[model samples]
Target: MSEIVFRSRFDNGRRKAFERSPKVSLTSPDFYFSHCFGVCRKKTSMGPPGIIWVASRVTQPDKLSEERFCEWYEGQHIDEVTALSGVPAAARYEAVPMSELAGPPTAETIKAAEQRPDYLMGGKWLTIYEMKDVDFRHTAEFKSLDGQSKPKGNLLDEIFTKAHFETRFGALLSNDDKGIKKGPGKLIISATMTPGSRASAEDIEQFYEREHVAEIAKCPGYVRTRRFRWVDTTVLKEFERLPADPIEPGNSVVALHEFEGPYFPMEGLLKADETPWTARVLESLKKNGIEAGFYRLKRVYGEWLPGSSKL
Candidate 1:
């Protein structure tokens, strides 16, 4: 569980509120709300979390227009997806642009010193859907989501930027819930990897779960994380996609690292418990190292809103 401590009065109120809301009552234990990560929850009590992301873009400049993209997402797409059996929770986020990546280390720009040009093939505005297993993408509900099960209005899909409307899958590897009030950060720093010729995917995955995450938690603003692979997609239908779609390649690796930050310092991570394995891991991926991006919170909406929305 998250290290979210509340005053006795507040806790009692939250419990009472949870008891009152039918949705909250039915979703308790499965959906634990937190501020650090907007409306996040584990897919299962003891299993890997299935992570999928969708990207969208802005259309106009008013509340109805500016947030229409998000509204369609939160109100329609997210609601439909999370309503599935065994599917406990879901969340959405906006990718923080380079303009906001100010201060010491990030001031230089996350991609300015681009060593791997082809890796950060993600979107600026993204939403993540978490489920009980990677196979949830293959469920009857998801089949509808894939445009293979059923169809009707599909209004939300109409507002999205087709090109930016990319999707990717990830298998939960490590999560550190001990850091702060919620997740470790106010921001999510991602590094999607492409294995090099000499790199062993098996070895890197094992090291990441066993050693890398624990070491990363030592960083100053570090929090929790959810790591997944492109292979974690639907077991049945292969998604039809544009040629430029990143996930279409089916050979990407993602690690969404959360941090309590105005920024996640590269030096901070390097300085945190610099074991010999850290250097080895770095050296291993040198051929095609981490292609990173920082995603910030845009707006969060769920059935438990106005109450646990701030939770």
Candidate 2:
């Protein structure tokens, strides 16, 4: 087998940190098998290489009004993070209620819509941050800007006390652009899961690449599909005061399907999953390890213009 070597460059300070960290050969089968979902293969059309930080939260509305939370998060917090080096862009999303996802009231559609885990269902807001590299989070600039070590009494400190946050880090695997319009889709459906003991990471990647993604692309408003393999989980220094019980284990894989529309065609999504191959793969995922959510883009920050709010 041909060997593919992975190399990286960093400044002196970062080099020291990188050297101290555990090393893994990117060319090894074990490395590819463990961290990637077949995107490492030469045949695969890989997405823009980098790390994505997905952060979701549910804030106490009674203590801090929704208006206040949105004003602070959208107006202040997002800009602060994006201004940092290595962080290029960010987007925010709001959960779409089940009632608004118009489609046939069939059993299948209803079941599919309601099959999300509690964390996803309860996380009313989500933010996706695009980083230039995986080590960006560990840099001294990030740590200082994070303000975790700073004294309390700031607005962020107050907001953290009133909200429950969950975050996961994933490396980009594949980005399939199928939408007519450029940038992010108005609607996004996120599915996350861990493969069963009998199934391997490659098995799930092949399913999406060969079958599932194509099926969904045939839907009316299909825009693009992006896949990621989980890397790790972290608690923002702000949320450290809260109990850790709410922090859930991260899933092994995540597939995001973006759509352009006033409303997603729930019926079409159900039909796409009716194939026997999809059924077999889904069944092989560990029990209670799968979760999904439907969200509408709310705001765009940094490099991209703001998305439509009409959804």
Candidate 3:
């Protein structure tokens, strides 16, 4: 029998190893997607090429002050990070205060956002960057041509000191919004968790790919769901040349949902569904481990500019 093979629609009859995540083509049959009966999807889409996610959270140090920090970040920091060859785009988000978050909130999620532990990256602030298929570790700006440490010069000086910050990098596993618009929407649901020690990561990924995501689509105005695994820093000798001590990644996978209009992302999540599927899913995540939150999106720059009252 002739061998049956699977490959992307973009494949030129050659199978190249995917660098981080598999390259899914536009015409693949098993595309990740869903539909909300009431919310119609716009006829626009902006997707990443083998998207790698880089998320960092931070806090304002005692002396730097919020105003100075904003001026510095808005004036320069955002540009520097986005300019890196691999990075396609960058955006900053301020965690909505626990009181303002939607539906019934999870206490642990609220606490984690407030505490901003080393593992959680930073307190109150999250900077998300979308990286293309390129390996950031090998970039000229990140490392020397001969494989040596390369300083970001004064840009490095401006960061790390002004606030407490850390990050986690990973590839796109599955996204309901794979072909959806990459707009700066008004709300986001960011949930992070590690799988049970006994269960392989693939098992968790497959479960979501097959079930949970579709169930969550029932939530009103749901736009998309993007899942990510912690980038294993040790893979490419990248950690050796880096400055920050990448804390051990605990919450290995993060599921982010984007929503717009008047609906809340957690309206469905916070309420326990009395079904075998969702109940088991939640039970499994808990026994395995989970940390999550509902955040109202706060845009930091551009046309959505704010006065001194904003962050």
Candidate 4:
């Protein structure tokens, strides 16, 4: 852990506090809410990081507006307080067409998209990014060199080459045809890495350095990226399981990259083409003696908050 450099807009005090204590209270909703509300209010005023909740659609699917969202819960709005408390700045990013999400959607995909915690980083539409950590400055490896000579071209790009890139031929048609709209076709790509026993903080830094990040960013159709440092905690059973008591982090850091192009990148034709790309990338990894990681993918509902100027 060379200092965790967050590419977010959170205030200094909150960032420092989270850095000091990354644990979230699981048992004490009241205490958690108070802290969360304060942070939310502060962020609302100063424009801090907005929290994204990642609840299962099956468990709690009906979407709610901010007012309703607060009403439905027993605890105070943690968004404001947490933002104020140095939990990292908070923001409310609503979906332009959030409700459009549907699926063979499974928990694995949802969990994959939410490489970080669902409580702090989740919300309606399977919250993806809070927009704070848009840069690729988090733990993840995007490259793998197979035993073959590291090719001059990327395996994925090669697979989706113009010659073989037609949808009929099992190529993913480009989203370029649909035109870029607010929430259409944006999917989240989440990668998680649990350091081996000997891994150190410095090792973490080297993993996400510019080289790896740039490659991930350069991946075929990435929209934006969000990286999260799990406040001290491990992977719990679900959002309802934590003790509500502030504690050490048990989970690993999570990095989310949004890929919103005209077509879905990993399905049907796209997936057909990607399979080989993945093989080549993995082979590359084996050759390079690097570890491969498990990844999750999700087609989620994301919206731009009302009156938000950035959309």
Model 1 TM-score (2 dp): 0.61
Give model 4's clash tally. Answer: 56
Per-residue accuracy of model 4 over 1-311 as CA lDDT, tens digit each: 00011112234585466567656553354333323222322112233232232322122223223343333221322232222222332222232221122345467666665454322322232322233322111112101112011223442122111111000000010111222333422555434344333344335445455333544555556554444444322111212222312211232344544555533344332343244433443243212222111123333223433211232
- Please name the candidate that would achieve the greatest TM-score relative to the true structure: 2
Q: Which stretches of candidate 4 lie over 4 Å from their true place?
A: 1-53, 59-125, 128-185, 197-201, 232-251, 262-311
Collision pairs in model 1? 170-228, 171-228, 184-223, 185-259, 185-260
Candidate 3 per-residue lDDT, tens place, 1-311, comes to 00000101122122132233465542342221100011122424433233233333323355456666656554665555555555546556666655345544577666755654333322455555565542343333533211122223542344433444334555566657632344545677677666554464556676677777877777667667777665432211111113223222433777777776544645576552445655555566544256555555554333221110111
What is the Å distance of residue 21 in model 2 from its true position? 20
For model 2, what is the error of residue 103's alpha carbon versus the real structure, in angstroms, after optimal superposition?
6.5
True-structure lDDT of candidate 3: 0.45
lDDT (10s digit) by residue, model 2, range 1-311: 00000111233465465457566664454333322221222323423344444544535667767777678778876787779776667778898877577643567757775765463545677777766554454444554443323323565445765665555656677777746776778898878877775354567878998999988998998888877766545443234422223223333777888899988877889999899888878778766557777889998877742221111
Runs with alpha carbons beyond 4 Å of true place in candidate 2: 1-48, 103-120, 235-251, 305-311
lDDT of 1 by residue, 1-311 (tens): 00001101113455466457554331233332221112223345444555565555443333226455555556665666667663445556666655444454464565574453454534556666565665555433544452332123543234422223445555555554556546225677777665553355666677777887777777777666566666432211111223322332235567777777676555766664387765666566635455676777654434321111122
Instruction: List per-prediction Cα lDDT, in the order shown.
Output: 0.49, 0.61, 0.45, 0.30
TM per prediction? 0.61, 0.72, 0.60, 0.35
Error of 3 at 304 (Å): 16
Q: Which stretches of candidate 3 lie over 4 Å from their true place?
A: 1-61, 103-122, 144-159, 178-182, 198-202, 233-251, 272-275, 281-288, 300-311
Candidate 3, residue 44: the lDDT equals 42
Weakest lDDT window of 10 consecutive positions for candidate 2: 1-10
